[model samples]
Target chain A: MNIPLNITKTIHDWLFSIMPEGVATVTEWVIVAAAYLALFAVAGLYLVLLERKVAAWFQLRLGPNRVGPWGIFQTMADALKLVSKELTSNANIDKFLYNLAPYFVILSSLIAIGVFPFSRQFQALDINIGIFFLFAVSSIGVIGILLAGWSSNNKFAMIGAMRSGLQTISYELSVGLSMLTMVLLTGSLQLSEIIEVQRTGGWLILQGHIPAIIAFMIFMIAGTAETNRAPFDLVEAESELGAGFHTEYSGMKFAYFFLAEFINMFIIASIAVVLFFGGWLSPFGITDDITWFPETIWFVIKVLGIIFLMMWFRWTFPRLRVDQLLTLEWKYLLPINLVNLVLMAIIIWLNWTI
Target chain B: MSYFSDIYNGIKTLLTGMSVTGGYFIRARKGSITQQYPDNRETLKMFDRFRGEVVMPHNENNEHYCTGCQACEIACPNGSIEIVWDRQVDPETGKKKKMIDKHIYHLGMCTMCSLCVEACPTDAIVWAQNYENSVYDRKYLTKVLNQPGSKVKAGIED
Candidate 1:
């Protein structure tokens, strides 16, 4: 692992030459962020169109197919329409906090994009504590959601934000803990190191022990809740709370929140890949040997697979009630994760590495 | 007792709860659920009373009963209706009569409440089954019910 500084200098020179000049770090982050924003736009488009299509299939009706080919551009058109609309904030709430909340949530979500190992050595910041940094950074959006609810001066947005705050905070405990178990076993906080561990020892999903299995499940479920997607989607329970925290927000600010949700979805899915499934690691590490397929392809495949599974979950079930949501969290997820951590320690002691 | 009670109780409840989500996760539909609307619009069926858009009826004699009555225009709540009026002198009576000219309705503005059809006394305008009303410009929406220069039937003046 002793790489020469000359090589490192060469890479630094190469990256500087290739990437845009002036605030290179910020520029790289901007690229990373813009890439994710574009992805959010695409995913939101797919998600909306797919949600409509899925709903139609569930109800035995045709969905939006008149916009583009198979209504592919329908979500785009809807987005354009929404953006053209007048953004209105009606209440006399704390205007500063009301406005800043969405930006904060959105900022936190976009910040999480940097930590993803899109390919080997192809991340925004190869920060040492990338994994923990991600969990810490991503969780700040909860504060934004809560502040949005509180600042709106509306009872429903506040309650939704409060529920989102508590729910995400509680689940994030397990997400962090599950990851702590990985850092403990792998002995590194870096995402690349975690991937290296999985690369050598196989993905944590196949880590052939009770603790790994338990941790993976906790991360997946908690991650889903973290994104405020369906089943755990009580934050903006449309039937009850009228579009949740950003109910009063409109136009591009609302678009930011909307885009952030999808970005957060990708972020959580990437974490799940890096921590559990395997970041850019292919089946039996077959693609690991192939020279043509860069490590990023494997990463995208695994990430997309997880995203697809989430989308499948989103369209399949009805929204869970708030009590059901808490029960699922406080009652079910937290305890299993705790036990799973304990079980993982025992497995590591037994040297039962998969 | 209280030490293990917190998370231990949570575990008992979570296992109880996950069985539900796990069950749902397993029991989800095993097929794609996307519907291509325009591609299959020709085959798509509409409900019995699905009000789409308004169209004037064309008879075997090529005569439309719309007698220049402005009830539909007045009745529309969204201002979606606009009637093109052409004055014609009747050959039989040698008198100028306002004939039901041309109709230009913006389907984009149409709420599909069937108020226009209800307001028309001559039963001229009826709801058409055509729901695919995607248009680029706002101008192409108006429909001319009667052929230009086609004489309005002899004494039909409402």
Candidate 2:
């Protein structure tokens, strides 16, 4: 009756029982890595399909519905096409870095995903400074983008890479500050601990009140910019820069960049889920007595809701100008985020949280 | 201050835009205007004036409205229409009459301009709404409008 199912823990224990301690730990790590890799790949493909479907609905159109039932296999067909496509690139391109760039982008996202607490006791990695680790790993993707552009030997790619770097760096501040505001309320950087705090206190958004809402808004805007999606998508403005940093890439290399993007979106949405929406906690304990309904389902539902919001933002808002993007960060979001953080700290000091 | 007001206005406008899209998203099932092209072929209706292609209608008696006047041939800008004709002896009148041997239409060359249909004095040619015009061979596009042994309708010339 306490939602007493911890499947991941049982699996961990069973693995240890069958092997020596060190070997068991190594095997567990391998299994977790493989599971996460599979999850990331599938999630990326489905997220792409979801984005297209949502975009169609917004524009009063019918999206892809031919390849499979309701077009479920459309992205799978796209993956096959990309795989069969020839890997074409300029002869003057730096071969080593050009080949290495996509892995950097994809690997960073995969690493960031490992720390997410999908449900109680379901996290692969539970590091003490989990949020900080996420921030650090997520930024490594920009290095990959920069390397790709520099090695591509194309002017547009170079300009796009520069824009991406500028955008990521500027928005990273607001993202961190907004998150730091919530860290004050929960008093921990570890994701699981943050969620555990929420289990009793209700969602952080409700507990911290006005400042929490402000931080949530700022976080969403900055998170969207960090992912380099539309509205802040100056990095690959097709009308201006022509496919951006991945301009010279083709076949699976281009697929890597594209997949990394959606995975990064999932990561951001997951973080928002953990920090503000009580991670896997059922709302108001309405279904606490129902043992059949798992906490992981609740977690996934929250993440998807946030992902839909981000997609809505992408389809609704026009891409911001480069200067306007910078102004929004420096002139508006940064100041507001900093003030919101302090207000959160003050509210915490006075024991004013609900 | 204007600075705070700007922030407030920006947030308001963004929410307003989101609400519009959200409203559509909720009603998206009923609101979508897309026509499933191949699937709805049975129920699909083309407009009355849609000039998909040119066709010559034949009556049950194998008689058509064309008088072999060659007006459509001359009116066609692309020369898509060709009328091959011969002077045949009319047994009833005991006189020579212009009759069509072949009424060739080159669908490949046609721009669907409807000029030939407009030029026909006897309303012989009209637009057909069949849009699936693809063919594996170019020869398939060149169609003869009049069937074999078909003759001009009685009193059509007068």
Candidate 3:
């Protein structure tokens, strides 16, 4: 069933009624931005805690249990510690670019969070070019990483930044092509429209059959690489580069880079949710009759599932060597992605989509 | 065909790896092998042969088997054991005999080699199972093993 409540729209109309149009719109923008900032900050912290706990379980160890029940407050305490720490850096660093780098990384993820259709009528920016906008903003984050590396005046950081640039550029093609393959089935780049199409035609993974599944596999791999996660984490290869590009960053500045990574992972997982799994659309409409169970919950559940899957990849696979990383992208993922895109187009053309 | 087969085998191995971790995750609550140290102190038991520290055993009458022979003192590699002795008249036998004034043990220098325990012909010293041996003062590590006013067991041969 469709979302019964339009809480965001109701609040918008109420604000416009009491104030002038310009004032109301600006006020609404401020509120939405503030809300998204809070949402992502908390989500990033908990995702870190979740990663530690999941890793512990996989290794058959008890994770953080010292803080508030089951170590819920461990990340909170860590964030506090990071905040109070002194912001130390090398004296030889470029002041302008060094200061600007973290904002570039964090703001891009926050902006991308705005376009997601959390539930019906709950989207902040329902732009027609939603998928393109996400891709554009996500690519901007690598510029931040590059700048952080270059400005730090450290060789290890510089090497990490270079690796990040190479990895992201290679993976972006597969990420785009895989999404493009799914776009062939839905015929729209707008995320809300994509979900709406899935609502009527069943999930794209089932409808488009083998090609869709192939696209999904490629998308997950590319998406993980895009976020600079493990197995593809040559960017900050702890063993080789010693924390990669942000080695010189300390205190809250380092935290900004750390938080941005988790938020980027969320964004990638959200995109996967919107495309492959039906975004906010219940499976077979089982819970459609229960109006109290919101569509937003369903959207969150799917996003978290994809995030967990990514985490599983992180803890399971070993990091790829620099050359192997390149070979995998160019020889393996890219070729498969291109053929899958063509296959999806043919499936749609011949009315063979399930 | 080999290229596709390589990809197939790679994915297969990866899945096998995931299954192993996933199985551990499923049984995580019971499978965790972490020993919460201080919390489990009541239940913690060291093996019988664990050489934690050296102790001189005393019987109910506060009498020990040591004849003040100083074999353990010579056998100790690091000079961890020292025995002070003086000749005294045996009350029952009315003859002069060697007796220990103090049996000093320096826990700090002891290497836990069990050599001193083995050198004792009378089996006076044995290894204690208590591993928590830390003390705030270095002086506390220098222990006097013999009790105050305690004597050697009657009829013990040197």
Candidate 4:
């Protein structure tokens, strides 16, 4: 709570001094909510542009350079195009569920973004159950995909949703187990406390060494699947599903789904940075005294590096068949993750980890 | 034992694939194959042998090599080329001579098979490297291959 001259606290104090206590709390929460929404609205847009640019580079091409300088405003132009498109509606589709699904998908990703401790002073919520909350909340995103597919009154959409649900559910186990391995080392689920442990012990990947590396690898693979991305992206396997669960969605509603996909990617990368790379912790204690460069900058740099890694995975690998996808989770990731968790426990018990 | 090896091999192949793409990503600045089209138009040059469109080459004296033999017109599968010839009195010879009035080329209908160039006896028509043949109206695609105020070379005879 002793954040050094944090802007959020300063604003809260100023608002409290000006207004009555009850009204001040509500108004402050409203303003904070608005700020979070605005921050992510821009972040989601640019993250997509970055993903495209990264994919383009991997394939030896310039992704976008038309909308603005280096196509910086490419996503903005895409947003305008999506907004201008007509929302085609079908009579047989379940209207309520069809409309409700996109909000749920966007909500899960945006809410998870709040749990990240961007800097010492930048966390919106420093809940003790931070890691647990992120898993629980992000899992609901699969439900949105399911609803979208089921309500669209399209067979292809239904198949895509079903695939997504299956992939996320199975992969969630590996993601949780890998995270549990790290939690065993840190002995705390709070994201801030995990960073604090890493600040003292160095990054978990370095400190815990072999087991942490295994866990990190497993986590990344499962996290990729959890987000319904390639090579595990059987959900909307464009060749087969024609855009998957959100196939029936168009215009602004489709944009919501697209934006949520990238935001979820950001959330996953943030979590990876927090747990394994040591969120906001300067490498080799190099930048500890460098007041000019903030911890948030380090956090962002690490998160972007991980996001690039994910993009690398996407462009490099082909889509796994549905069977191969499930086999990857059940036969490969699950077993390795369970064994890695056991190894992590024994290492901690023996006081052998650095 | 095999299970452990399976996991190891799986990770090994995945990393190998990642390295290939990672290398390309790193080398992108030096190795990108992107042609920035309109931006690089001024510097862009077509290959000498690129058969973009056929043209009747005119020299500085406003004369071309076309004899209006109609061989190119006969070779065209799509009838994209039209040769209009007329019997005109040759001033020097004092005899009626067949001279080409116009050679029309409809680029819209052209398949660019290079058959016309192959059939031209005098090499009057050759492929021009200008590929940007798109026009707003379809009628604009029909072009007169012979430049205005041009005649057949005086020394060219059947």
Candidate 5:
């Protein structure tokens, strides 16, 4: 059950031999951080395309097809137009916070990506408490929104931001607790460890238990709220508020908020993919047997599917009222999540290990 | 009892939504019956009597039915029409006559109302079914119907 001392010594020597100099360590962090930012941008653009296509499918109308094949480059054209647009603070707003708000949201969203494990060894920094770290980074995104809303000094902006903050905070409890159940089962907060647990044994969804099923459902609905997507996008209700928080801000600054939102949508979907569906691991022995098949591609497909599903939910359903949204969280979801947490702890104590 | 009732209610609600969608799903084949004017304008080829913008049909003389009576201008609420004129010499009678110099209509301001056409003494201008009127440059918008080079022969025919 244990490694021989001689074999362990040899492995240790091999590891140290591949280790780089002190300057190389700094370069490694810089490369990973830069890569994370690039991935953040790519994920944002992909979400925009997915949203449009999914919306079109639901509404029974062609969304965007002129820019490129399947309207893939429509977001790029939109970005170009936004870039050329005049940055106007035509309405009076707290200039400093209003300008800085979008960056804050983008930063928080991008940081959350660091904690998501794309593939087993493909993560930037395999932080030990990855799940906790992800939730923490995501929770901080509301601060930027709140600042944007409050600083704008517009009633609509303030109301929208306040709704966003409350909805996020309320739903996150269920989302975080649901994630905690999986972390409890694996006994590790690291996402890679959770995926490995699912792969060798089976995906948690296949593990037949009432609590796990309930938790999965709660996690998905909560994740939708976390994204501020439809059925919960009271924050940016165009009918109610002109544009919510970014009503006053125009040009690239407004665009940044939009991009951050789509990126955040991906972050939610990625977490769902990692925690529930086997992350990077194929559905059956089908993928595991093929050594030539890349795990990263499988992982990307699953994440993209999750994003598409979120986009579908946004377009297929009407939005929830502010009171209804809060009620769903407090009355139904929060209780279910708490029960799931308690039940999961019992399952773990019973040593339900495959 | 409550749990069963709730489940029943959820099912009923879901079926109701599906029914509404089902109706549209069936009718989606009809596609709102819109012309998609930009892409398929050539194929649909609306008839000349489509009641679009009015065009002054020019004869061999290019003389339009508009007599510069300000009827269309007065009828228009949006101030989209301009009637200009100059005196012309009647070759037969050797008399000065008020002739239409130009009729400039800004389609941007025109609401496509048939009032001007209705008020016309002569039925020279009628709806031409030309709906593609998007343009840039507000100054270029003010169109002159009777351009400078238009040799409109207003001489009476036998």
Candidate 6:
């Protein structure tokens, strides 16, 4: 894989030369972790504002222009309000797991974001099992939802948790299978390597063309379900479940669950961009000649494009019925995903990818 | 196959729905229905016939047409209007007259029913169309319709 010039390397090299190796290594890890956390905290806040604005636009209304210019600080205001709220609790519930759940959910999403190749220079880490790591870490969030529901001692929360559990379990297969279809073309599990392959072959969506399109469609559908977003958002189907698994959580704890959701959405969109669209790779290599334009700009644009698509899906589509949610994954997505995978295998065997 | 067509139809419908939202998102700049209420207050004009609150109209000379007939006071279902009058001698007619001292309109009790406006014989009271009548204290809602220093206009026949 091509190691692009990264800022992290400069910092690491400088630190190693100046300080003892053990102290330098620890300090570098701390700096990187703090940087990622700070970046995502800001990203999470704005993403909520973006979703609100997009939803308003879809409904032909102007959203939240009161807090700051075009209501950009609306989520910041919401965060402040949420932090000051009381941690209301039911006396009979299991207190330990109920309290622990939101942190679990938030941490899982936060950890997955570390592996994303924002730009070649901006990646937190380029582990060989990057894609695998993301999938594994992200799924752990379902356990948090399950714990929150069970410990809440509420029937609606339990049902919502159960729905979330079943939905994530079933849809994850499709998410894996569809992503694997693209991975087949890249011939690597590492996300950076996948992007490196796309750099030459163009976007995987354009390279594999039809099958890639199919896989894209499947991946998006499953990823939406995995994130517990709408169309597949039967988990918090508010009409039925009354705010779902995080129903009992209040104050800062509830905010953790809420923030985790937007962060998870970002992670999903980032993955879609890295795998299908060329991550940090300019379209048609148009910006390659312009030395001044940063590669991270391309990555951000592509990620935002995918996110807009996801938000559009959320606002347009109605929530699926519990049975329909399962059927969509099992009957529709699973079958099409398998067929698409086979078609991709054949194409790869024939060396037909661009 | 029917199964394949089902999948195709599903995706087709999804795309169709997406396009509808996408169309709105694109056209939102010009088509947004939000009025930005407080910001647009200077330009916003309520409908002419809007029944906001009852007001007694007067000319610039502070001469109103109310004769203290108590027609509106009787007509109000919720006892929202009260006309307090004192007997005074009319200089022209040399007769005792019920001249209004204060016309009390309890807006807190008003439902904008327009019954009082319809019941007035002299067309003394009409809808002001000033809907932003909200106040912190309930007592502040009880407004005097007639401006201070207003008096009943002198008439020929009455």
**What TM-score, over all chains together, does every model reach?**
0.70, 0.91, 0.85, 0.91, 0.83, 0.90
Candidate 3, true inter-chain contacts retained: 0.69
Point out the higher-scoring one by lDDT: 1 or 3.
Answer: 3
DockQ of each: 0.11, 0.70, 0.60, 0.75, 0.20, 0.74
Error of 6 at A57 (Å): 1.6
Alpha-carbon DockQ of candidate 5:
0.20
Off-target runs (Cα >4 Å) in candidate 4 are: A1-5, B38-45, B59-63, B84-102, B147-151
Give a tens-digit lDDT track for model 5, residues A238-271. 9999899878777788888899899888888788
lDDT of 6 by residue, A51-96 (tens): 9999999999999899878898899999999988999999889999
Number of clashing residue pairs, candidate 6: 0
Q: Rank order by DockQ, top first?
A: 4, 6, 2, 3, 5, 1
Model 2 over residues B19-71: C-alpha lDDT tens digits?
Answer: 99998888888979895666566787888998888999999999999999999
lDDT of 4 at A85: 100
Q: Candidate 1: where are CA atoms >4 Å away? A: A1-64, B1-158
Better of 1 and 6 by TM-score: 6
- Candidate 3 TM-score on chain B: 0.77
Output the better candidate (3/5) by TM-score: 3
Which of 2 and 3 is the better model by DockQ?
2
lDDT of 3 by residue, A153-174 (tens): 9999999999999999999999
- How many clashing residue pairs appear in each of the predictions shown? 3, 0, 0, 0, 2, 0
Please give, for residues A123-213, the per-residue lDDT of candidate 2 as tens digits. Answer: 7889999999999999999999999999999999999999999999999999999999999999999998998898899999999999999
The candidate maximizing DockQ is 4
Error of 1 at B139 (Å): 17
Q: Give lDDT tens digits, candidate 4, residues A239-300.
A: 99899899999999999999998898888899999999999888997987766566787888
Deviation from native of the Cα of residue A339 in model 6, angstroms: 1.9
User: What is the RMSD, in Å, between candidate 6 and the native fold over all Cα?
Assistant: 2.9
| Model 6, residue A273: C-alpha shift (Å) | 0.8
Worst 10-residue lDDT window, candidate 4 chain A: A1-10
Q: Cα miss at A333, model 4 (Å)? A: 1.2
